[model samples]
Target chain A: MIDPVLHAWGWEIPVYLFLGGMVAGFMIISGYFTLKGHHKHSDFSSFYLPHISLFFLSAGMFALFLDLEYKVHVWRFYTTFKFTSPMSWGAWILLVVYPMLLLNTLVSIPKSFRNRISIFDRISDVINRYPALVKNIGAANMVVGAVLGMYTGVLLSALAARPLWNSAMLWILFLTSGLSSAAALVHLISPDKTEREVSAKADNGFLIFELLVIVLFLVGLVTSTRAHKQAADLLLTGPYAPVFWGFVILAGIVLPLIIQLLAVNHKIRHTPVAPLFVIAGGLLLRFVIVAAGQASVIP
Target chain B: MSSRYAMVIDTAKCVGCMDCVVACKTENNVPEGYNRDWIVQDVRGTWPTLHMEIRSERCNQCDEPPCVETCPTGASHVHDRGGVVLVTKELCVGCKACIAACPYDARFIHPDGYADKCTFCIHRVEQGLDPACVAVCPTRCMTFGDINDPNSQVAKLLTSRKWHTLKAEAGTKPSVYYLT
Candidate 1:
């Protein structure tokens, strides 16, 4: 029946989780900017990045679909709501993402862009008539974004069998990492000088916090049962160590973090390499956790 | 009281012949390279102080089955008949959440894309027959009955013997018990 860990989830899941986390990160950043009225000056937050989230989300969903053994039964996720089921909650949460995205897009874009589409023009006119509602939508985006980010990690921790993922710290680590990675992307692409510095500063803080969370995560496992200790070893000294320590930690976290910190302090100029490393590290974080968690046994 | 089925295996008597496995495969039409039940030989201690415990294991049919709880769809559910966990093939997306949630490792994916596992032979049980595994167990080490009934053989064995369930710390409250 169980065959130990089953190891059913593979690369597709990690890729999907990574993209989902990134998409959540984008939502939070866009939402924060919209609320602060920074959207008026920031093209990346208002027009481009939010729309790019849609494309990334679609790609993630496609990867998820590919992993399903019974693709036709995918619709069954909506047939009923199992409150205890994280997958059920994740499916419904994903549904909310699209409408929230489109609605926010209608209100956040510049007048010139909205004027290009007649339908968008009418919708934005109706939506813009109430600035209060627009503000509320901005807040909703951040709330939903936080939930999405948490869901990516919560689903794994919910599986008590896998000791590697059975920690409350996992979701916090994921959320911080998501935010930091989003900030890195913003810093890399945003044209506005003020916005670029603000995001880079935020990223510096997030990276430091993320590193702390990662330590707490490992500590949580090592201090628990022997089963959990062995699970931690999968990342620490086992087969997954090279990638977890080498790619995700050293290259992904430490390298980019040092670069971003220097850039944030104005000691050095921002380079594309650091942001690229942050994004790549964010993705590898998911893959290593998913794979290592699958390899962990209950016994 | 509602019927609560359970399995009690006497590890002291079991020889790990795996008759229960073959019978289960054949009776349930289980595909090759998969099983609903199997034997586990746990060897503890070192060289001269070795202690081997051979027991037949299957789905714990936990009262708090995480497989059913974590199932994205309602595919993995408990049967009303005796709280037996079963999956509806049509509803399973095979996302493998149930597979990961279960610590007992009592489930496997059917090549047909459904989460397949020991069903306690509910069909045969309904006909007043034991599960295929229990019936074919060569040592007669396996006992099957409703643990809810205080007078049932399983309940009596569990009450009288030194028995333990796998992953007792997991809080799954498994229905299967092993008597040492």
Candidate 2:
């Protein structure tokens, strides 16, 4: 059994973090596609991704809400903003995110759906009237999505108590992982040949960067104080070693990279298994980090 | 003048009976299966030269508390008069950020959905009485008073004895001192 003192945070936190990162990843992928004019090649990239992003983000928010002990008093989170508090910054960032996502979803409505749905038609008409506004929205999405991706890692790193989380590399690690997962998602869903090829290539680059970041993250921990070294050991040689090495490192990173590379080189046909492993790896990364960080605390 | 209250604990005199832990829980009404204070025992060296050190630990009530700074709604704050770290239940969102930021692991989630920790027994201190744990110590190992007052026991203990604080590298500047 885990020590009671270390149980302050549980499964709810990792689930929330996974969902939050996934949403941010989707936004970044969709924003990049829209900005680079790749949306014309794939209908899924242009219209459905932002809506899917919103749905995932809303679900993540619900998970966060469930973690709070006082659900009814959650409104207090927005009453005042504390600059030093990452939670406060996240709350404000989320407030801006919802509206931007909604507008993106409204503007990307397909003509078939817009014709069938009066509300979508009216919304799309308002958006079409201000053609220049769409450019600004796409730019805003990329900026906000990047921040949201890094913010998840910054939130944990800000906690000085957890040696495993105090490293600056955490933000970069989380961002690269988020990007890789987002690209993999697009690769899986987009039927357009050109779109899939571009996404697959981007995901391969992100996976390589993610592996480097993860290595740096662990190196930073192991080279620091005794407490930090102990934190690193929890994943390196301790009880969590098998999962960290087997599931997270080999299966999550190596296998996905191998599969994506083969697909890019046309050595093998692309399959859903590659992206599925990437997503699983992303979620496992958060869970291991959270659980091990808590376990490594000095009593 | 602002009063900076502090504690001076003599580790040599601590028997590790957990009286302070019991007293703190009772005085603070800490829920079952939770604790506001605990005793940590460190044993060093091999069998022939074995040496053991036991110390009762709780919130250090640091001067620059990370818990207060990380609290999103200002629920964790230092008491202005006596420098006691406290939690305002009404404002706490129960986000557990303070718990994560506290290196000492001194804070816990109360059943009422708020962060809870040792308040330095502010209710008793305000009435000019010793905190429950301090008052009930059989060995009189724990000293509590305004460290700024030259005449106070805690002040005299600090001046006369060699002392150290826990996790000095953390740079929190804890008010609680331990004498070996």
Candidate 3:
């Protein structure tokens, strides 16, 4: 029967959110780069984007698997996709997004037809048959990536059980966080001058958006209609307090903001440290927010 | 013929003995570490002001089944004959999406690594027998019947008593009703 209490969640749920955030973040950043013409004739696009997308997607899938009671049976999700469930949406997103990313990876091989027939010819000639199609597919992947990023927020926000996460603002917050973290990771791994400049602008835009969303999220928490105010208390002083303040607020918000400010002001070089710090902050932010949202300590 | 079957539970008579829980596990041959159905007991405060209540929670077998809708490969589907939700293990790719989608935590991963949950004992019902839980409930707190049939025990109870479903706000429209 309907009870006058919140439904308790398992630890795996939070981890699932965290991983999803990361994957979405990476996909967004990668998409942003593609939009800005980062995936031109450079071998970097061929080598990095697909591989990284696969890594993040696989990581999120693994986290989802770990969240299950019978994790080994997780494959059943592939065999089973229900339209009414958010889990189904996520699975569908993965199914579409991952293959698109893989396609980008496959076409990167210059000689696709040769690879198919020549087993030895790594770059076959078949991809040339559909160059226009391949490019369109690349663009599609970016769009899919952006949608994937937003869906993570929608996933949690759709769960009415946890009032703290039940806001449309979550979609914006998660998407911003995802893109910011993705840019941060890119800045850390590759120091390409052109990519770095573009990433910097994207980072600035994302950081500003995230800061606003965080404020709005907190406002929602404080002014909740029900016992949701407890979530605010949890964020401020409960088990998630240290995480919220330390990682989300301090490292994620403050540190990144500071680094961006210094870089914009010419006070600091665009060194690896700043972006690395931002990446760390972003990852930590996801971890804490996810944890905080799932924790229910109403007595 | 299509039928909307249901379970009616009388929480007032439940003694928290977990007999139904055990019976469900044994009847379904549920995995040792996992339970397709179980009881959740909430007791507030210490001795003096303490209030105790036990809820036998399982897959609500909602009319709008989220698990079935989320199954990408059609592994989980509603049986049109009895409106019972069933999971086809052979078709299941083992994706835990259904588990996450189900708000009740009713679904669990089976030993064979497929999703499984309470099926309302369709097999037993086909044999003209009550569900194992209904047969084994020492307090007779649980009842199963065709809500469509006015003469069914569940129909009588629904007409006579106030009942509720868990997480009704989720729009799952669960068939299982509880009288607290």
Candidate 2 recovers what fraction of true contacts? 0.47
What DockQ does each prediction reach against the true complex? 0.59, 0.53, 0.23
How far off is residue A36 in model 1, in Å? 0.7
Chain B vs. true chain B: TM-score per candidate: 0.98, 0.96, 0.93
Q: Is the docking of candidate 1 incorrect, acceptable, medium or high quality?
A: medium
Q: What clash pairs does model 1 have?
A: A1-B105, A1-B106, A1-B107, A2-B105, A2-B106, A2-B107
> What does the lDDT come to for candidate 3?
0.70
CA lDDT, candidate 1, residue A136: 77
In candidate 1 chain B, where is summed lDDT lowest over 10 consecutive residues? B104-113
Better of 1 and 2 by TM-score: 1
In model 3, state the lDDT of residue A6: 19
Q: In candidate 2, what are the lDDT values of residues B1-180, reduced to their tens digit?
A: 689999898988988888888898899898887788888887889999998777888899999999998888888888986899999999998889898888888888888888888888999999998988888888999999998899999999999999989988887899889987
How close to the true structure is residue A223 of candidate 2, measured as C-alpha lDDT? Answer: 93
Listed in order, each prediction's TM-score against the native is 0.97, 0.95, 0.79
Candidate 2 Cα outliers beyond 4 Å, as residue runs: A1-6, A116-119, A129-131
Backbone clashes in model 3 = 33
